[model samples]
Target: MPSESPCSGHADVEGKVGPESSGGPPTTLHSAPQNSPAMAQLLPSDVKMLLLMSRDPGRYSTVTRRLWGHIFDSLVVGSLERMALGVSQLMRPQALGPVIRATAMLYFHLCPRCTVQHYEAALDTFWRPPVKPPTLVFYSYDDPLCDTAHLQELLASWQQAGMPVWAQAWETSRHAAHLRQHPLEYRHALITFLGRLGLVAPTARL
Candidate 1:
């Protein structure tokens, strides 16, 4: 994975389209759902990765993406820790780099239901600039591991109260499995969404 200047807010992860962005494969755009009031009727914009994790145990089995990721992380972390001893130490110095990288990956692999410390910042959060991630599509089921209902309520509040809307979701779908179960509909939905921003070919699948 390629990295970018922290100041840019985007780490160049399979570029989806954005401001001052360059060099990379197309990543999935995280933006307004088809019926989002903001993206649908208000000012529309495409953006980098959407931050929400999708739940639906179905995805763990059907979505090769996450399974492969879990594999890769395990291999990487195991590799690193395996060779890190003292003299002939178990982990090699170079291995440490991969381990460190894997450690940071935690921020992304979180389950759909989560909470964070309430932000009470007055000014500079990151002195450079705040990369406001567009509203994300957080799909979940009644998974005991996450707070699905809470996320739903939060999304509803944002959409109804009408936040500038990172992007509003139109009748939301649940998690990554939505893709596996409804491939065509999922494709159509994503294509339709990104098409509005001119990122995808008009007649192509998303």
Candidate 2:
């Protein structure tokens, strides 16, 4: 079967669209997706390979939970409340500042009860083991959004489960922007992976 890379996120799997090259036999290059692990959960049966770039696995690893929890809290509680809390903290006396600010930040923005149920439900649906396929991951240690340690752990789990997984990590780069930051290395990694899968000509150059 012809290989396919289905990129997904907020849109359902059936709605995913891949851009194809114009001059040659149709060749799909890329698509946008919100989360890699979540997308893997919904991959079409015919998809023989997966490529993930700078996305969380949607599992509640310690770091994943903390990062996503903060995001959910911010969305649910709103920015005005956060801003007010910040301003109020600055107005308070300096002697009690650190303790008061920490308390206020937690109270105003890190309250899990407000979003825990929804978060759990989402994770439950998105955290399933990926269907058997060779997987490639691109990530950076310095990305503030997606934790590198979490990816390492997740990749290890996948490998232990006997999944074929390959990863490339950089010390510094913008999230989802590795290609722009390290073009030759990124292209080499991608082409090398696809070539190994026999999805592209072994000598093909992007």
Which candidate number would show the highest lDDT if scored against the true structure? Answer: 2
- Candidate 1 lDDT tens digits, 145-168: 124454455445545654222222
lDDT of each: 0.29, 0.42
Query: What stretches of model 2 exceed 4 Å from their correct place?
Result: 1-12, 17-127
C-alpha displacement of 119 in model 2, angstroms?
5.5
Candidate 1's C-alpha runs over 4 A off are 1-138, 160-176
Model 2 CA RMSD to the hidden true structure, in angstroms: 13.3
> Tens digit of lDDT per residue, candidate 2, span 1-206?
22222222223322222222112332233322232212222222112112111123322122222211000000111132333343344344766756655664564355443323323333333234433245567776665444456557766876787767777778876544577889998888788777766777978999
Worst 10 residues of 2 by lDDT: 68-77
In model 1, pairs of residues that clash are 83-90, 83-91, 84-90, 84-91, 85-89, 85-90, 135-166
